[model samples]
Target: MFRSIITGSGAYIPTEIQSNPDFFTQPFYSNGLLLPSSSHDIVSKFKQITGIEQRRYVSQDLTAGDIGAIAARNAISDSGINPEEIDQLIVAHNFGNVAAGAIQSKAVPSLASSIKHQLGIRNPACVAYDVLFGCPGWLQGIIQADAFFKAGIANKALVIGTETLSRVSDRYDRDSMIFSDGAGAVVLEYKDTVSTDRGILSASVQTHALEENGYISMGSSDFPDSDPQVQYIKMKGRKVYEYALLNVPAAMKDCLDKSGVPIQNLKKIFIHQANEKMDEAIVQRFYQLYDLPAPVDIMPMSIHWLGNSSVATIPTLIDLVKQGQMPEHKLEEGDVILLASVGAGMNINAVCYRY
Candidate 1:
């Protein structure tokens, strides 16, 4: 049987960093109205609640596809493979390719096509497509690559999650503080192996569309003179938090069970870096389900410094840990890892694997 193994990983974070204190230095507008709050208090509260010290944002010169291509190139380079050798390219993104400061995004041709073009791949048989599963898009892309590998349809695939969420963020809203711009990528290759104990063990994905309406939305209405500001990322923060806390743990536990991976065997649980507190609560509850206390380092998080990059979160975190950029998190041969995410479709997914 064919099993998929990650051959390489890469990430691209914009140079500009937005810190909590920066909010205090600038005026915040909400619903076209200036917010009335002290900067120090706001910063303190933001740090306390979100635990984000800062996040990176693309400068006025970059587009979503630019960073994504850069990440793809890096992963390809790391894999030491020629661009023409790739059998497929999959990009996961929300707003497509938007300029740094643009309010509206354009999706024509798809970011996957743009990335393939940017890489100068000449193979017409090499398929390219985009996945839109919210923050779980990257993980879902990985899952799709594995499916293709197992089906004898592809030998090598590149999966990427890239977003310029800052372009779609409403600075007037509090959720604005949680978003940034970035991309992450991985190269997966089919490996002939008799070992059933390695590679992707299982993946579980579910969507709760009924509960997601209004929980998270993008773009504005068609009415004339509708505040142009309406075309920005919006979220019912409290509802999302509660929904995630209630559902994500169960989804993760079920994924681990399906993968035949005991919860305690995980070397690290890489989850969507949406919220520090919410992620903690979810992990804690995951342990509670198994009647075990949560380990201090079971979950490796980059959100405290990187903010939430949606689909880019888990892949980027994995790249950083594997590269030793995240010193506290390390992966050895035969190590087990769990990747999971939740976001806009009210979607939740988990992937279990051994590396």
Candidate 2:
């Protein structure tokens, strides 16, 4: 069997950080109407509810592809691999700068061309594609890269997840505060077992799309004949909470089972940084279900401060590891670490990696 190894990883966030106080204090009208006298109270309540200290958004001129391209370039440079070695590029995104339909026609191809031009890569054998899987897009991209590598169809692949959620945010809705803009990328390479010490062991992904628990917002039509802007994000917080609490732990268990590693033996567990409260609840339930001590060795979450960066969360964790913020655990050569994520579209994914 072939081993797919992560050769390099990178992430990029805009320099601007918008704290809750700044957001709420700004004088902004929604739908051409001023907020009522209750605006202050609503802002305070929202801040307490989401627990998001701040989030980053790119300048108005920047697009999701721009941020993703920057991160991809960094990952390629860091991997010490020439761009010509990359046989494929996969961009996993939830929101594109253009209309969703426009992306299928133009956006991804433009991004691929720009990256290839900037890197001076001239590989006619390379293929580029885009994927949309809500928040679990990056994980799904990794699984795709693994398959291509195992088939000997590719020697290297670049997988990127980038989102400019701010563009689709409902300015008046408090829920928009939980999302931000960012991009992250990973370079995957095929490696012989004799040459690599770390590689993917197993992966599992599932989606519950028929359920209407959480979904994007379709704009309202006020007049009899008007084009509605169906671009904003809408969600049912309570229902999403319940679904995540139940499904994420089960997904982790499945990955562990497939990899033949006991839950207690995992040195680290990097879950999707959805929210602090949800993270705590999932950790507690996992301990109860597995009959082991809670995995206290897990990294302190970066989501509360960063907000939800959609698919960038996992590569952001990998970036944290590179920055030395992730705690050092005694991970042996063959020990396993679990990466699990639950996202919008009610998707859940888990993967096992040996380090």
Candidate 3:
């Protein structure tokens, strides 16, 4: 059986950084600002709770697809493969392409298709599409790519996760402080490995179908005089936090158990950069599921420095670690890495791979 091996990866984070203070200082048009606490205590409380320091936003010219294309180009370049050699393109994203200054998002044509054109790929046979599995989209894309490899449909594939949450975020809303813009891409090639333990070992995805109602949503904000029914991202934070803590670790344990990768064997686990507290709790519970103490270094997070970029979180973190940007964790040929995410549509997914 052919195995999918990740050959190269790349990431793109916007240059604009906005800290918590930046949000508090922004002009508010509405009276009932979400900040019910003292202005002085808001930042400190936010830090104590979420652990996000700042996030990046794109300038007025770039779009989600633009950043995704840049990351894709870098990934292909890193892979040392010609663009035409990529047999598949899968982009996992929340919002499609939202221009740098635009307030709306659009996915008229798939970002994968856009990146294909940007990379100057002329092969009509190269399959290109997008996956919208919430924050799990990118990992889902990778999983689908692996299937193509196992089915003898593609020798190599480019998978990407990109998002421009800044466009869809409600500036006055507290959740806006957590959203960011970024993209990440990886190149996977078909390989025949002698070790059955290496490469993609196993993967699984789960969707809580009824979750769309209250957990998280993106659409019109209720503020008056806002863009008439202008859509923006919203969330029931307590609900999401509770649901994540309850379901995500269980899913991780399930994937690890199915993959036969013991908790002690996992070198690093890259979960979605949604919330620091939530992720930390989930990781702790994950180790408990194996009757092991949670190791601090087992999970490396970019949420403090990068904020939450939705689906972009996992791939970007993976690319950063692979590029030696994250010295806290490293992947070797025999090391096992766990990729997981939980987000909108009440979606959760995990993948086990030996690097």
Worst 10 residues of 3 by lDDT: 26-35
Could you tell me which residue pairs clash in candidate 3?
Answer: 219-231, 219-232, 220-231
Superposed Cα RMSD, model 2: 3.9
The worst-scoring run of ten residues by lDDT in candidate 2 lies at 97-106
Clashes of each: 0, 0, 3
Q: Name the candidate, 2 or 3, with the larger lDDT value.
A: 3
User: Which runs in model 3 stand beyond 4 Å of their true positions?
Assistant: 27-34, 195-197, 211-213, 222-224
> lDDT rank, highest first?
1, 3, 2
Q: How good is model 3 by TM-score?
A: 0.95
How much lDDT does candidate 3 score? 0.85
TM-score, each model? 0.94, 0.87, 0.95
Count clashing residue pairs in model 3. 3
Model 1 superposed RMSD (Cα): 2.5
Task: Please give the CA lDDT of all the candidate structures.
Answer: 0.86, 0.74, 0.85
**Candidate with more favorable, higher TM-score: 1 or 3:** 3
Candidate 3 residue-wise lDDT, 29-133, digit = tens? 333444456544666676788899889988878888999999998888888998888899999998899875666567878888988888889999888999988
- Model 2, 1-355: lDDT tens digits are 4688777888887777988777656443445455564656666776666667888887766777878888898888778888777898888887665432231223645455555565677887778777777888888888888988888788799988888877766665556778888888989888876655578989989888776434543443222233354445666677778888888888888888898877767777777777778877887787778786586666457776678888887887776675566556344467678888887777888889976
Best by TM-score: 3
